[model samples]
Target: ECISSVSLSSLIAEEFDDFPDAELILKPISDGGDGFLDVCRFHFSGKILNYQISTPYDNSELICPVLYNIDSKTIYIESADLLGLKVVSAEFRNPLKLSSKGLGELLLKIENDVSSGKININKIIVGIGGTATIDMGIGACSALGLKLFDVNDKEILAIPENFNKVEDIEWDNKTFPFRIDLIIDVDNPLLGRTGAATVFGQQKGASESDIVILENGFNNIRNFLQNKDITDSSNPTFGAGGGIPSLLYLLLNAKIRRAKDFILNDLGIGRLKGKVDFVITGEGAFDHQSLMGKGAGIILQEFEKRSSKIFLLCGIIRNEVNKKLPDNIFPIEINSFFQNKDESILNIESGIRLACIKIKNNL
Candidate 1:
């Protein structure tokens, strides 16, 4: 659950070697993020819906979940399926044209279901962390109903290679039974230096030229919205889904929320208010950026409120970051004692086992 496949697979192999004949039932765990989709499968009471959808790079199909939170009157959409880059190929991993239509299709499915059941929906919290393309928000709109036309009044088929070409949008959105809350994990703005195109483009294989194209396209989308007669949604969740949240804001007028809030409210974490003793967490890396809206920072903050003992593990712990750890917590860098020059997997496993051993000893 808290372990990556690389680390998990290797860990299993090591356990088998040590025991030689142990019969073990292995289970995976997630730390309240994308992993929750699989871990909480048994608890979900709604119908499981799957659909054929497009990727950010090329058109394809992805399967996803349509979670209905009855108590809160919300529909929870897990984005790990369609738009997550972990599933898309490198050549097909274009964030510039990534659309949340797969997500849209899921929500629309839920909407029809809930509507038929006559269940009132107050919110639609779309968890957008790992995604493939970055088409602002037009892809989802086009997939839904709105027509994104170019100069000739013909609909724009693929990702917007350039922004100046967008002519107009005709939205015939059916009256949604409820509002939408696009829960984005990152804080990058819609465009510019610290925005989506620049901050996340490189990881998704967008070059300097691609970033420029995406930025200019986003700008054009912005201009189109400003001139529209309807309400302006430029200031919405423009940071999520490579600014897809903001795109939804302008195109579909969705309410925005932090991913943290979605988890907090959904989990009712306050129930753990005076019951915890120690908290342990780990991640791929730790740095100054981890302090800003990252899962690590958020976990530490929540634990701090309870004055819980926190044990944190990471693949690498930079000197500057170690200086910021609070006294009650143990922050360990797996690299100090072990270094495998040839095998990164071995290095990661040694790190995890070492960190777990330290925590086990401490407890």
Candidate 2:
């Protein structure tokens, strides 16, 4: 069996081609990150509202996706459009300078559109992940009318490097007319060793020194919030989207939900229980991280609850072969078919087809 999530439509098509006679159900999945809007476009019949927003790196404009459903009075926004790493150039991928201000700007724009009768929105669903900043969402809060000041009572810019200089935060009393739901990809807390900055800072082009700065920045915010008795710094999923969820939870009273749960519930996956014989799911790479409540892992767990067989086919498997997995669960590591990573990746289509064929024959 073979399956993929997010950016693997071509791969899924190829798999279908190989098993033309087999009954296959194709469901494109996302953990509220990249490719979220693409999946939402398929499920929701809505108008695609486009807005030019500033990219994470500089003043470059990016056309962001906001789905407006008139029937449900809901709006869906993918955070990656404004905060994804891909929006920043490789040479300019510095988290310290990046700000999530664009996200706030987009939200305000949505409100304006709604107020003008251009769009009807009562609830805003934001998919938050694959971000390029570690500013603890201070940048976004700044745009949302939160004032950050330095010890000298001067306003401080909402950037990662300036987080440590924040002496107080003042709210502008601005409120959105719609309720907000933030779909978080990970369950990591906002601060600590396994937190956002420590785990994801490097991927955003942060050096060791820069990581420490981000960590300290996050700590400062946590301390400030805790002192006010507004929120607990140890909240899980607080670290998602570079601590975007934490601030949103505090400022907007947004509800944070697991991306997998949100997707499954929205799609009505419970109806498929027992009707489906097997479930196949995979990602670009499978490791301990996949088990960390990601889309694929959650899919597996969901199917397991239904007592269905599960097969995971992935480009690479980082876990040891001897590692224990569920009894009915089988993992097909496509990299094992080739001598090296390059060769395996180069021939991914062939590998997936072969893996599916092998699994079919074995069963």
Candidate 3:
């Protein structure tokens, strides 16, 4: 029911189309999830290479875009394109049967291209967010040459359903050809109350019983990897993308970076040399989590230092988060302008324009 950042920015721009003697800069930010590729395309002049990758639910494939910055020799990948929850149908959202195999396939394709001299690359930056599976990336590892076997030494598939059947894990010793940087949106450990399984499993359509299965599966695999000294579940960033980063960290030695840093610094949001006057940022909902490394919180922190007059607009704002706002930042909740929640979402375009109009009048 929420408007996209791009659409919101346009609405704001149209409202301030004739403002007297002022410049308007539109910067649409993403948490490296659904709109990651679009945001990358917006910021950088690069080639978009599309490849058919497997879907989250089955073996079928879809074309996903990969951004390549020629000058920096960096390749940006949005994990959600191949294995995001939004791509899967509501009925097929079960993590128990899903696999992250598509992600591995894409990575292998990129590696093959590099090895064949088709493209030049020094770093592969993956935005890991909004994934559907919680198999601890066993499925992806399988595609990348990680093998699993049962107690009888018989090999088995590396899916969540086969986790309990797995007795041994074998790595093909395949190393990534380039530096791997994983960008995570949330800071959650792989195992605990706020871990991947407990915190995000339900939203992916996992039931209470299914969550138990997933948590147990993750624990089993974690212990196996621990014996080999490949990975530790204590790292909070490992929880992003249903534990995909954990296995990547173990196998590819991927470095974990917060979305705030990657999106702001590497993507040029934090690299603006000139003085910025005003900044307007918002999210679908502003809550405690928004303050914890989310885009809006990071934007607030970044612009607060510049003494810019900031306006934080959101569909809904929690009272606790509102109280904690800085003195320079003004909070605008769209819901307050509507008769009810339904009306606000249905007429979100009007709500955004009204919010911007209010901001202009205040100035």
Give the candidate number with the greatest lDDT. Answer: 3
TM-score of each: 0.80, 0.91, 0.94
Q: For candidate 3, what is the lDDT?
A: 0.84
lDDT of 2 by residue, 243-287 (tens): 898888887788888877786888566557777877777776877
Worst 10 residues of 1 by lDDT: 24-33
Query: In candidate 1, what are the lDDT values of residues 1-363, reduced to their tens digit?
Result: 235533453464454455433343322322323544543343344544455555555556666655665665665565665677767777666565556566566657667767798556777666666666677766676667866679988877646574557888677754467787666666677877778787888877788888888888778777777777544434534756666777577656677776556444544443554566666655557888676666666667777668557777766767788887888778876656555423444666666666656765675
Q: What is the lDDT of residue 337 in candidate 2?
A: 92
Per-model RMSD to reference = 5.4, 2.7, 1.9
Give the range of the ten consecutive residues with the poorest summed lDDT in model 2. 1-10
Instruction: List runs of model 1 lying over 4 Å from the truth.
Output: 1-33, 39-47, 68-74, 115-123, 229-236, 335-338, 341-353
Give the per-residue lDDT of model 3 (tens digit) for 1-363. Answer: 277677777778888878975688888887776777777777776899988888867888888889998888889998888888778889899889999988888889998999999899999988888788887777887888899999999998777878877789899767877998888889888888999989999988899998888888788888888898765667878788898988888787788889888768876778653367888899888999888887888888788768458899998899987888888888998999999989999989889888988898767
Could you give the candidate ranking by TM-score, starting with the highest? Answer: 3, 2, 1
Clashing pairs in 1: 1-28, 1-29, 1-30, 2-29, 95-133, 95-134, 96-134, 98-133, 98-134, 237-246
lDDT of 2: 0.79
Q: Tell me the TM-score of model 3.
A: 0.94
